[model samples]
Target: MERILPSGFRFTPSPAQLIGHYLARKLCDLPIASNTINDADVYACVPAELDSRFPSLDRFQDCRYFFTWRMPLAATGARVSRKVGSGGVYKGTQSAKDVVDANGRTIGYRQSFAYFDKSGKKTEWLMEEYGIRRQVVDGTKDLVICKIYLTPTARRACDRR
Candidate 1:
């Protein structure tokens, strides 16, 4: 039973809150503080359709977050095809960076991705994928929390240094 909230409601958790609280509880099979996060295969949908596909309490109604499995395409867990959801691929724009906790310990990883059109043209859509190194109860890779949104500015403006 999913509880739906108002559209204007905001769920702006910090990186630590997202990983330490929501994600950790989810993997441990514990109850979340709130039913604000949705478990979905984010790669299966396009960035533009996320809001309607997996709606949550978005801040300013401009962004969306999803909890998805970090399942790789091959058994080796090295190869993956991100090209799903309407014939486009969400290519990684940068390397995976560490998301540290208050004590400066790396608790999870974050990676940025930019969507490219079917013709290989870069779109204004952007995504930040966060994942941990721990495996789930089923012995799969860690679950991921993806923050997807359309860039408020030009694509390069959102490029992290």
Candidate 2:
């Protein structure tokens, strides 16, 4: 809610930066370069509710990022739950796809989802979920980075191929 940067500033970190740097530091409880990305119960709220959580920080109107905890769903083991909020569910368009660094080293995993309303109607909202590799941290990871945005027109172009 506080303005830490100049007006009209934009913070669009790449997938590498999201997982390799910020998220990696997050797993270790380290500080990041900016407070633009916030902590939230991502799965507990519909994508539309995000605006209220961070407000319309002018420049961040189109994209919002959050650090959320992944709850273990299995009865006896580790299985990150995907149960979304009552308003809707995030239907996975792609599962844990490998995200590699520029040098071709696997840094983390990325999952893509399209938001569907309670009635099962797809919405324009989309999300990219990122989780870290053990190489970045030494233990079982529970926290994740969630980036939510409207579906880009470029996505339709990609699908054309």
Candidate 3:
């Protein structure tokens, strides 16, 4: 994957996580499952209602568009164990809270994610929200996300980069 930087040089999370935990909380409404075929391939178990709830998914799924997938945000609640089943990527309950951005007057949110690996091991990652006052931008104003694969120790080992 190519890392897109601004013309002058700038950095920001793809999708802008605007609404932060609020959007993350929205993910809770959408179901996600690890592909039994491949652990790296996480599948969004989007129900039919989601088609109406989030029309963007349809547009993103369009192969004609370069953007073939939506921003994947997922977490399990108390029932996560029963949700993911076996051969899953991450498991455990996750929660997000919205917070104001201290750096600017614009409102922003952040989500704190906690979950366990397939081995019943605990893990956590902090995801900063990006979307607000803005919607979507091609490679320019959009938030960039790179999925880095970590070891059991949770140390970065490799990624799509």
Candidate 4:
């Protein structure tokens, strides 16, 4: 094996961890990383195919769910964006009870997205057509929120229009 620095020489967190911290600090505005984003979350974009084939997805609506919403990134123009799919996400740990429909069929998946403004205001959107609720966790300002349900074909129509 090639010789390497001993464990004592290792930095407190390691270079990789430091880089992660630095990059996250540079990229993520929120001090707390939003649970909305993950490998699974990026893979969970609406029109599932777009999430899979990105940069080359045509007929996006064919794969099912899709949404386009904006939240404050810093000022008026900056924003964090999200596109959620209609088909359920495949997280492997999600319970059937969490995703199954009342009729015992799986409808689209439910995903929540949050983005914090530079002012430290966190705005969140829940993407799903059925049974959604909101809680005022604290005395923060509420931003404009909109929710719409789209079928695969409807999404395709919106894409062309």
> Against the true structure, what is each candidate's TM-score?
0.79, 0.80, 0.29, 0.19
Looking at candidate 4, the ten consecutive residues that score lowest on lDDT are 124-133
State model 3's lDDT: 0.28
Q: Across residues 1-161, which tens digit of lDDT does each residue of candidate 3 receive? A: 23333344322223333244333333355432211111111223211222233322112121110111223232211121212334323332344333455454445433322334456555442222223333433322222111222232332322222
Regions more than 4 Å wrong, model 3: 1-10, 13-17, 20-86, 89-95, 101-109, 123-161
Model 1: per-residue Cα lDDT over 1-161, one tens digit each: 35676655678888877888888888799998667777777778777677567554543445777898666666556544577667889899898888889999999988899999778889888988877765344334557888888787753363543
Q: How many backbone clashes are present in model 2?
A: 0
Q: Per-residue lDDT for 5-83 in model 4, tens only?
A: 4443322322232223422342344362322111223324433244344321123222212222233234443223332
Model 4 steric clash pairs: 46-84, 65-85, 65-86
Deviation in angstroms for 87 in model 1?
A: 1.8
For model 1, the run of ten residues with the poorest summed lDDT: 133-142
Clashing pairs for model 2 are: none
**Candidate 2 ranges beyond 4 A from true positions:** 56-61, 75-79, 134-141, 153-161
Candidate 2 vs 4: which has more TM-score: 2
Local error of candidate 1 at residue 7 (angstroms): 11
- Residue 119 lDDT (model 4): 46
Ranking by TM-score: 2, 1, 3, 4
lDDT of candidate 2 at residue 113, scale 0 to 100? 85
